[model samples]
Target: MSDESEALFDKADTLDEIRDKANKNSNLEMKLRNCIKDSMSKVDSLLTRNDTTQAQLTRHNELVSFMKTYCHERAYSFQIKKCQDVSCNICTPIRLPQTVFDSLHFLPDPVPALDNPDHYTSFQAVYGKQTSEEFRPSLQLNQANAEPAPKSVFASGKIRDYIMCCDCGKWHYVYSDKALSQDEIQDFKQSLYTYDYSCGAPLFPDNHYLAELLFVCVKISCDTPMEILYYSSQKSENSDICYHCGTDSDFIDPPVKMVIGPKRPRFCGPTP
Candidate 1:
């Protein structure tokens, strides 16, 4: 009887192993399918709009900015444990694109607004106080004992409510369930195509809320992706962190106007 019981237990363990493997394979397959489908949809939409002109490109650029915020969030799966068990061969080391990682780290570190024990303070939170004040806002300061905040806005595995427009200062609601709906995103692109994009508008500075963030004075009559030369240094190939802003990219050049966050704080010190 003991021999029979032992044999049955061994069989049960093997069956459990098979079930676990099946479940894992299903999960990976689902993630890959979603990613590929999303990419294909984007390509198809662009193809249909192949007659896109420069003005249309500007409009699409706006959509791209909005899409980028939403799309970039999908890069890592919140549902998956990035680190797996020690026995798992793929669990040894985690590597991400160094440039991307550096940019991700820039917003929350040494930004002056983010280093506080509470992690952030807006100008409203500071009100009648000096910038040098300890940014402790609440009358009770409950965050002192509150649980640490989640890293990403969409930690609940869903997109957030609305995206703020960089231009026109409007909010666009997004629906994540369907793929590539010709919603306000497409409309936004069309608006740019017809827009004269006249100059002399209040342009948002390249770097915002930096202690030394400054505006670029350009008199160009046309709308081009404005570059902000805050500082200069020749970096080696591997490092993508720009010395001033703590991030670098060929993408998302400055004067790319933004609506939300502490934008283009005026320098009371030296002019840039």
Candidate 2:
């Protein structure tokens, strides 16, 4: 062959080699891109699983803490003493004290005055402020001015009373005067056991005396029979009364007082 023809053949071979290299480079780049995408997808999935696990761990920790604080064996039985005064008629219909009645004014009325005329009129006369638009009856006014009202039928001389757990010595308030039915007692117990720690304790108004009553009812119903006591006079040593939990009071330590922000800690117990 001529020299020029040989050079042309060599050039063709070089061109073919260059094309093969280019194709190989393109395939390598594509493989690298796919590998990076797979790695990133795995990383994202791992992150999601880690976050879920962390959330589960936090919830478990909260439940464990709550269980440590509240769960314990039944060491005491609750005792409620009804007023046995022959002349005192406070327990007939369970009338609320003046302070409790006044506190009700701040709450949203479930039944508006227009909806229930009789209830509204009676409530207004007793609790509502006297104004030109709303005039209270003369009889109620006379009764209000006549004399200071007597103490409540409650042993604490209030609409509600506090009783200490005989086992833990933690004070819990009782709001309801009437006894709970069997179904109600079981429901209360279920609620107490299944309470979610994630939501924290249920919030109640400062005057919500019934907040801790369910705890008392559950203890009385499930663990032991309630011990009924009687008080003839308000001066009786009722404040010192506690549930008859089998544990000795002398060995029980007082619960650590829990305080909320910018508010005085309650002596009875935590808000719940």
Candidate 3:
């Protein structure tokens, strides 16, 4: 995440003020940029109550610069890179914030927005700004016996164990540890991915508990021979149909893992 974005989240009140003013001026793009720009400036004053680090300060300027250039240099909407039917055409999987695709509304074909990018920060737009997948949290699982660290920005809790696929380079979270109850376990299970969405939570007294647990793909290797694989979901559909294949596969609790990840990777957990 950009330092400005990280620092700005807590300054909600300040963001609102600037956003209100920009909207009043009838400049929605300016409103968003003002919100983001004003958001970064107010973060320390309203939320941190202290100054940001020099490094962070530098990054804050960078995001502002990017925002400015986005409005100045390029058009908001554009073509998205996706799989093509053309045999020789490349179908590199480009995952952006759902918002990017959602804002434009999934059209008959994926076309770049005729609108401005500043108006919306789709999961794609925000995340796509990142340099590589390494910036993302890894789906690594430690030994079942090991204690978990703190969760990620959106999700929290001690992750006891997880699985990493060497072939496919996919990560799966496993919470079968003693720390998680049947309910908590179910919660994490149901919320495999789709963090921004509200309805995806593993519920209690789940009879067809298997009905939950969505498939979240971290990376779709074009090689077609990925070493590892895991599934996640954004909704609670009864069918566990594979994204690649429509066939419903039996949902495994521990996940039918033939491999593992690096040693004792830490996640959000109790303060040791």
Candidate 4:
């Protein structure tokens, strides 16, 4: 018998014992009978590996109901396991370009925020700390005659450039304003196409939260480079676990913006 069929048989046998111990007209007996009649027959006639039969689907639903009753009444518990089976296809193991991975260099690790755990405070977070705390009676007196402060150069907005390492599947950006020329752009597109990409640094630095966990891209070894909206935030020394892959990584600052490329791709392995 199939593993699924054998499992159902075992469940049925267990339910039978429960049925015998209960009143003949009990709900337990009714539930078990319904499971066997509606679900088990489908499991018995299973014909293929991938496709699930309607009877098998019914069996699953019944087993869930049966278990719910068992757990609630008997105070027992069960856990659902995620499947991690691999496909037998020729395609997979998409590798990233070596140059992109090589280009990744270490940025100084950020200091952790004292209050908000997920954020790292930079120099800007502390720049005004000491000066702002001083009690300046003269400054307060001159405030009425003070002209509006001029806009800081740092506040003048400018777009940034980014590149995704096809191997790691992570996007990286140039902190400077040097744009890639048409030839360089074309060259990057051609060379990285079809190369394998596995996210190497799952805990790498990010602007806010790591962009890998927030963004999803499926560029084969051949597609043209794509643009994406990325949210960068202030990062800290502490890391947040990815909700999807469960990898530990840092978060970046608050503002989200468009980025052109990938950082080292965060590895998202098969989940169990």
Sort the predicted structures by lDDT, highest score first. 2, 4, 3, 1
- Candidate 4, residues 25-107, lDDT tens digits: the string is 35544555565555444433432343366565456654444344322221132332212225512123425565554443322
What candidate 1 gets wrong by more than 4 Å, as runs, is 1-31, 39-63, 67-109, 112-272
lDDT values for all models: 0.34, 0.37, 0.35, 0.36
Q: Each candidate's TM vs. the true structure?
A: 0.15, 0.18, 0.18, 0.17
Ten-residue segment with the worst summed lDDT in candidate 1?
227-236
Q: Give lDDT: candidate 3, residue 175.
A: 36
- Predicted structure with the largest lDDT when compared to the true one: 2
The C-alpha RMSD of each candidate to the native structure, in angstroms, is: 23.6, 32.8, 22.5, 27.9
Error of 3 at 156 (Å): 12
Displacement of the residue 196 alpha carbon in candidate 1, Å = 54
TM-score, cand. 3? 0.18
Error of 3 at 172 (Å): 3.6
Model 3, residue 66: distance off in Å is 21
**Which pairs of residues have clashing backbones in candidate 2?**
75-245, 75-246, 76-245, 77-245
Q: Against the hidden true structure, what lDDT does model 2 obtain? A: 0.37
TM-score of 1: 0.15
Q: Give the TM-score of candidate 2.
A: 0.18
Over 4 Å off, model 2:
1-169, 196-272
